[model samples]
Target: MSVNTSNELRLIWVYPDLLSTYGDQGNVIMLARRAQLRGIAAEVVPVRSDEPVPTGGDVYLLGGGEDRPQVLAARRLRADGGLARAAEAGAVLFGVCAGYQLLGEEFAGEEGQPVAGLGLLDIRSERGEQRAVGEVAAQLDPDIAGEMVEGGAPAVRSLTGFENHQGLTRRGPGVRPLARTLTGIGNGDGTDGAYHDHFIGTYLHGPVLARNPALADHLLTLVVGHSLPPVASWADRLHQERLNAVLAGKTRPVCKVQADAEPTGTRRHRHHAPGTCTTSPR
Candidate 1:
């Protein structure tokens, strides 16, 4: 049945057992939180390899995983056919790293063997000779930037996160890129991700949405068919801090928070402006 109301939304986390790694499941958690903040009921469903994926969901997410597991996930999802059914009925799909690769027609797998994918997005991945691993910073593609930005928050235009993958994806005619790289190997051609209609794919991993709520809200907006409230000051600040850190060449340690550190709302990086950054003592 078509949704006539946006009062409630279902967020599906596909294949958590075989396709979730690098804290990527956090993306689903953040999505749920964003919806609650907007007073929209959100149900997060974590489907494992052993279960049948529920086809009735507003948004579905697939996260990064190891090669062997990725191959398995692709095989299982293809066989289950739930994801394709959901997408055909207008559900939004988001994939990251390994999940990103498997959304396309095919991807290079263990030992560079070929693995067929779901073909939801007209893209393909071939394992690069050298892995791209580090903090990556990118400016959103203008079209995506305009849709994702809230109230003209410039920081939302810049995306920052950690990427550790070997797949060099190439987009086909059906998909437009999600961002242009400013500091790392993205798509191996300066782009970081691909999106077409309601489907999006990317490689960034700080669970992505945690570091960039604008992107999170953008996904939510698509499902809700409207804009979201302004991001919390702290969320915008975190986005700015991460963007600046990598652009200034700060490594992972600079973005680290202590185990007992103050709440994210209370802490601020010394250099909060773009292009310049410093880690505030925790």
Candidate 2:
């Protein structure tokens, strides 16, 4: 599909019911809103699991889901074969968590069985003993960030979000990581996401685009086929505030509290000392 000649863009949100458990639908909403903010008309399309995947969308999104649902979705998607065709036709794809795994060669199933994936990305996932859960902060790959931003360089140094997954993803030959983890376990390999051509897959789920508007704008840029002029909004302020809080917490020192002495009266005094908590500088 060529760039929408009438300034409209087609955005396909795939399998919402099966893959939107973690508020991943917000990514689609954010994309559409960002497009509208930039004066580009966006037609958001929801592709249910049972429906045929459209092969003519400018952007396609797949979100996280439970193990069984992910397996089913993957199978259904493979059967349709529209997504693979769309990618080949220059469609930009954004996949998160389970969605990310399904875009790869394969992912571990509920019983540790292998679930075949779309093979759009040269990565694979395996179940880990521990599930990574909590906030995540990472520095975007400089080269990738450069391409995503307006002036050929990223305005922010890092992107922050929450991650909760048991899958350990590793990049295969020729697959470049989207970012390097500064905090939290990502992919169990220090990398946070994977990207190649116009496809991006990640484990982040602050509905990612909501937490990282530059990334959203980047997706818009991909569909619109031109660099977009920066536009300010209240959402940008909120995103920066949340990012600041996360990064601050990541770097903040921990304090240890101890009783100074046994209680001799009605109350006891307490002593506190700063604990040695270190994080990699952004």
Candidate 3:
């Protein structure tokens, strides 16, 4: 069957068994709702054991999981680099929690071993003994972070979410953060989040997309290519306003403990204004 243009965003959710932490499935529903609001159809494909990863999806989501699941999922993904190729093709890939950890070249588990990654993004994760959990507040880069702010296009209705992770991801050869962890940054070494091209990886939880509609729109834009507009129409505005109101109820205060914990500058890379691209730190 030919793809319908009205709702033509293809999404692939890889390894639910090895992924899916803290109700990550909610993310799928949230994304679909946003797509429907914009009058676009979204197709979400799930990849399990021994399955060949599909190509040409508008976006990919990888969620968090435990040690056993992470090992199994990593093995499956590393055996074939199809996801890497699709990402190289400019497909928007969003990895969260365990999903975020899998996108890196490797993650160092608790035993201090390097687990294989899809090498889709320039970062590495090392497992930690403790889990980073609690509500978080973050300052996003204006250019990339603005749309998610309140009252902005594709606005983020909630500024807080649960961050649950046991490892920290260090910036490898390339990658900037989509948001920072106010406390540990999820990168065991105390880095926040990382970004590369259209790829965004983070440890934040509570169906993050539901709280960050602008991010959902950004992902949808990648999924549909730049052809479709966001849900900015009158009807969409009404829907979003209602959604924002619902989110207001769920909004929690950012953990004050991490507030003063500015992420340590691991690299002396020059800072550039938002929107402009900077080379990944050395």
The whole-model lDDT of each prediction reads: 0.78, 0.78, 0.63
lDDT (Cα, tens digit) per residue for candidate 1, span 103-196 = 9988987888989999999888888777777787877777888876643333367788789998788788888878776667667665678898
Error of 3 at 57 (Å): 1.1
**TM-score of every model versus the real structure:** 0.85, 0.85, 0.75
Off by over 4 Å in 3: 1-7, 146-152, 155-159, 182-185, 188-191, 225-282
Model 2 residue 112 lDDT? 81
Report the lDDT of model 1 for residue 256. 28
* Position 146, candidate 3: lDDT: 53
Q: Is candidate 1 or candidate 3 better by lDDT?
A: 1
Report, for all candidates in order, the number of backbone clashes.
0, 0, 15
Task: At residue 218, give the lDDT of candidate 2.
Answer: 83
Model 2 pairs whose backbones collide: none
Scored against the true structure, residue 131 in model 3 reaches a CA lDDT of 59
